[model samples]
Structures are given as structure tokens and as C-alpha cells.
Target chain A: MMLRNTSNAVYRVAYESVSKLSRKLNAAKNIDELSSVFDQYLKYLFNFNALRVHIVVGSDHYYFVFPLKDENETEFWENEVLNFEEGLLENGVPICQNLNAEQANSLIGDDVQNPVLWGWNFQYEDYCAVTSLIADENNQFSSKETEILGLVVDLFTLKYYELITKAQLVEKNKLLEEAVDIIKQKNNWINQIISDQQNVIDERTKQLRYQNEQLMQLSVLNAHQVREPLSRVMGLLDLISFVEGDEFEEEILPKMKESAKDLDEALQVVINKSIEEIVNVFDINSDKM
Target chain B: MNRGSNVLKVLLVDDQKITNFINLKVFEMVSVENQTIDYTDPEIAFRELDNHNPDIIFLDLMMPRLNGWEFLDRMKSQKIELPVVILSSSTSPEDFSRAEQYNNVLDYFTKPLQRDDIEKLLAKL
Candidate 1:
């Protein structure tokens, strides 16, 4: 009757411990948060002295050790654990255990009394996470206790995968935001260039209109000024034709010479004005540049 | 009238002496038996209007003392009835349009005047 009552109490404790651990694991948001939760509760839940979690994603191996009392012991355990993982990988097994007190003492050290090493190799897709639990002799794990520990480890592995996936999503969102900012800056730069070019084009168009007006004025001036002298020459020639032979030398010759000189002077004025306008236009263009 | 019975009395007013000389020679070439009087000063020409009693007056537009428009204004105030023709170096449309506004302005001619222009004036006279 006492044995039956003790067994009932143990079953109830195990059920409550697993339910609490499962709740904590589900609530974990990140790797750091999950690691903290495991560190705080694993000893109380399974009575283990040390806990080691090894997560492998691609070529990278992440080691998470708990209650690391001695640095030297941690280093030694890490080498041993790596060797054990390698052996498991070679054999293509998912779990390995060394529960003998004598073998555990010889392999690990005297610090642990009756150490029971439990290791698991978990794979989800291409990624693998291997975990090991070590118990001291004073709180040596029974088969029932180790089964509960296994359930805890399984929960931790699933939570870890969830945390890693969430971290990757956050990184991708940050990169996408940076890319959007760069594209906006480039568009603003291109708009500024287009506006500058439009200003130059507008200025050139205004200058061309002014030049056209000046050319039209010049043409009108030429028609009036040049025609005056030409008309005088034509009239003088008509007079020369009408006059008798001797009368031409005395009367028409002097007037003809004067009219020809006037025509030459008028032509010179037009040429000078045109050259001045051309030079002014060139100077205006050079200044713009 | 002083030169002959059928001869016309012609008055020529220009600021340039060379222009007056050319017009006088053109009149002689056309074989017009007329009494021609030339004046370089517009004021002198206005003063001689009564004495000459010219049948026709050829006037220049641009001058130092008095421009053609101002001369015409004076002529209008004085009630002068002589047939005046504009003989100018300017072919501006504004000048032509302004000349048309005067009642006594018989014609507008851009110099140097052709024989055809002189002949037309003579025919009108």
C-alpha cells in the first residue's frame, strides 16, 4: 500500500513538472529567452547537475552549457561531447546513453558522483540539434526521470527552431527597408538633373527669340538705307544717257561720281552693323557658357 | 512765269545742297522751260513762298532747324495753297502715312526722284 501511494505521488509530480516546462517553452520568443528559461527550470524539473545543448545549422555549431561551475570541466566536457556526437553521426543514430556509474566516473571526472550521460541527435529538414544531460550521483536519474528529461529536450529543440526562423525574418525585413531608402534617394537625384537641364533649355529658347527679333530689325534697316543710294545711282545714270556728249562731262559726270560714293558709304555702314551684331551674339553665347 | 508764258515756276527745298543741285539738273534734262528756285534752309524757303508764288514745291523731310512735318504745320497755319510733294531719303511707312494726313501734300516720293516721277508732277501741274 505504501509503495502504491509513493508511485502515485511521483506520477503526479512528473505530470505537473512536464506541463509547466511545456508552457515555458511555448512562451519563449527568442534563443536568449529560451536559454534563460531552460537554465532556470531544468534542474528543478529533472534534477540534473549540468545541461548542454548543441545546435547545428549548416556548417555552424552552437554550444549552450548550463551551471558551468568550472571552466576546465566545461572545456573537457565540450571535447568529449563533440567526440560522442561524431560517433553518433557515424552510426546514424538519434540517441545515445552511458548510465553506468563506474564508466561515467572514468570518462568524465570525480566531481560528478554517479553521472548518467543522455544525448540526443534531432534533425528537422537539413538542420540538426544535439543535446546532452548529466546528472550527479546524489540526484541520480531513474528511467522515469530520464524519460521526462527527454520530453523537456524535445520541447526545447522545437522552440529553438521557432526562435531562429523569427530572427531570420527580422534580418530580411531590415535589409528590405535599407534597399527601399536607397532607391528613393536615387529617384530624387535623377529628378534634380532633369530640372537643371530644363532650365538650361528654357534659357536657350529665350535667347534664340531675342536674336530673331534683332535679325528682323537689321533686315528692315538694310532695305531702307541701302535702297536710298541705289535709287540715286539709277537716276544719275538716266541723266547721263539723256545729256549730249559734251554736256555729260560738264554736268552729269560730277553728280555720277557723288552718287557712286554715297552707294559705297551705305554698303559700308550695313557691313559694319552686321559684323557688330555677330560679335555681340558671340559674346552673349560665351557669357552664357 | 518770269522765264516764259507757258513755263512753270518750281520751288525746291532740301537740307543737302547736292540734292537740290541734282533735282535742278534733272528738271533741265527734261527740257522744261521753267523758273526753278532752290533753298537749303527750310526757313528761307518759307519766307520766299510769297515772292516765288511757285506752282509746285518739292520739300525734304529731315533738316537741322525745321523738320518737314514742322514746316508743313507752319504752312497749314499760314493757309498756303501751293501743291507740296515730299522728296525724302526715308522710305519708312510711318513717314508715308503721316505725309498723307496733310491736305496740300500732293505726293510722297523717296529720293533720288526718277524722271517718271518729275514727268508725273509736270503732267499734274
Candidate 2:
């Protein structure tokens, strides 16, 4: 009856520990958070002195080691882990072994005496995870314990995939926001360019109006003032037509010469004035530019 | 009407000496019997208007000292009854309208005055 009572207590403790470990794993948000949870809980649940986790997704490998005993031992363990062959643990198999100092030295280049080694391999989709645990020979793992540890490794693999997927989603959101900001900036720049072009059109319209006014003024001057001398030349020519040869030479030729000179001078003045006005308009436009 | 006994008196007033000379030549070509008086200055022309007692006057519009419009106004005030014609280089409609407002102004003509225009005036006389 006492043995039955002791077995009931042990079962209750194991059930409580598994519930607590599942809660901690579910609460983990990132790699660092999950790694800390594993470091805190896995050793206590499985009675391991040290732990190493190696996960490979695509070309990337994520590795973690907890409670490193010494630099030499860590170096030796790292070499063994790097050279470890696959297929040692099959899909449904878990490995648990006890090693002497000589065996440990041959495997890991370390003289660790009577070490207990346990490892498991798990795969989900295209990703793989390999886990290793080391303990003192006095604390050899049972088959039931190895089965429980296999379940823990599987839980870690699923949590790791969740953490990586969440991180990728966050990175994509940041990139999308940056792309939107760039589009908004380009739109603003195009609006500014359109406004500047409108201003240039308005300025050109004003200059054209000014030039039209100058042209009208020049037209008026040409019609009235410049035409006066031309009329005199016409009048002189009419008189020459009326008179005979010698009379035309003596009487009308000198007057015709004078009238022609006056016409030439008037035309020159008008041309110079027009050129001056055009130059002034160009100078004003250049200054604005 | 009595072309043999009575001489036709003609007067010309213009700021341009060339215009007056041309008009005098035209009158000589038309008839040497007609008396022609010409002046470059409108003020002198205005003072001599009664002294000349011209039968017909050819007046230019734009002149210094006294313009054609002012000369016409003075002629009105002095009650100088004479047939006056505008002989100007201006083709402005406004000048033509303004000259038509005067009772003494017989017609408006743009220069240089043709033989046809002078013959028309002679026909009126």
C-alpha cells in the first residue's frame, strides 16, 4: 500500500512538470525567449547536465549550447557535433548511450569518464532539428525518459518555426511601409513641378501682352508720322509729271531729292525705335530668367 | 464765271515749303492768268487772308504757330466769308469729320493734290 502511494506521488509530479513545460513553450515569442525557456526547463525535466540544439532551415544553421563546462570540452563537443553523421537516429528512433573515458575520447577528443549521451532527430516540412544532451553516468536516462525527451525536441522544432515565420512577417511589413513612403514623396515632387510650369506659362502670357502693346504703338507711329514724308515725295513726283523736261530738272528734281532724304530718315528712326523696344523686352525676359 | 475779265484768286497755306512750291507749280500749269499766293507760316497767312481776298483757299491742317483748325476758328470769328478746302497729308477719318463741321470748308482732299481735284474745284468756281 505504501509503494502504491509513492508511485502515485511520482506520477503526479511528472504530470505537473510536463504541464508547466508545455505552458512555458507556448509563451515563448522569439528565438531568445524560446532558448531561455529550454535552458531553464529542459535540464530539470530530462535530468541533463548540458544541452545542445542544432536546427537547419534552407542554408541557415542555428546552434545553441547551455552550461558549457570548460573551453576545451566545448571545442571537443563542437568538433563532434560538426562531424556527426546523419541517419544515426531514424525517424521514429532515439539514441541513448553510456560511454567510458576512452570511448568519449575517441568520439569527442575529450577524456570524460562514464558520460551519459542522449540525442534525437526531428524533421517538419523541409527543415530539420538535431538535439544532444549530456549527463553524468550516475544519472543514466531510462527509455521512458528518452521518449519524453523526444516529445520535448519535437515541441522545440514547432516553436522555432513559429518564431522564424513571425520574424519574416515583421520584416515584410517594414519593407512595405518604406515603399509607400517613397511613392508619396515622388507624388509630391511631381505636383511641385506642375505648379512651377504653370507659373512659367503665366509669366510668358504677361510678356506677350506687353509686346502686343508695343507693336500697336509702333503701328500708330508708322501710319501717321512716318507716312508724312512719303506723301511729300508723291506730291513732288506728281509736279514733275506735269512739267516738261528742262522745267522738271530745274524745278522738281531738288525738291524730290529732299523729300526722298526725309523719307529715308523717318524710316530709319522707326526701325531703330522698334529694335530698341524689342531689345528691351528681351533684356527684361532674360533678367527674369 | 467771267473767265476773261476777272482773275481767279487762289491762296495756299502749308507748313512745308515743298508743299507750297508744288501747289504753286500746279496752279501755273493749270492757268497762268489765275493769281496765286502761298505762305509757309499760318500766322502770316491768317493776317494776310483779307488783304489777299482769295477766291479759294487750300489749307494744310498740321502747322506750327497756328494750326488749320485754329485758323478756321479765327476766320469764323472775323466773319471772313470764303470757300476753303482742306489739303492735308492726313488720311484720318477724324480730321475729315472735324473739317466738315466748319461752314466755310468746301471739301477735304489728301495730298498730293491731283489735276482732277483742282479741275473739280475750278468747276465749282
Q: For every candidate structure, what is the RMSD over all alpha carbons to the true structure, in angstroms? A: 9.5, 10.9
- Candidate 1 fnat reads 0.32
Q: Clashing pairs in model 1?
A: A114-A137
DockQ per model, Cα: 0.22, 0.36
Instruction: Provide the DockQ value for model 1.
Output: 0.22
| Stretches of candidate 1 exceeding 4 Å from the true structure | A1-15, A68-72, A76-81, A94-109, A142-150, A203-209, A223-269, A284-289, B1-125
Kindly list the per-residue Cα lDDT of model 1 for residues A5-119, writing each as its tens digit: 9989978987887788789879987787788887777777666656677777787777777754444354435643466778655564645465475556554556777566766
What's the residue-level lDDT of A250 in candidate 2? 78
- Tell the DockQ for candidate 2: 0.36
Q: After superposition, how far is residue A59 of candidate 1 from its true place, in Å?
A: 1.8
Candidate 2 Cα misplacement greater than 4 A, ranges: A1-12, A68-72, A75-81, A85-94, A105-113, A168-268, A277-289, B1-125
Instruction: Write one digit per residue (lDDT tens) for candidate 1, span B19-59.
Output: 78778878786656778889999999999999988888899
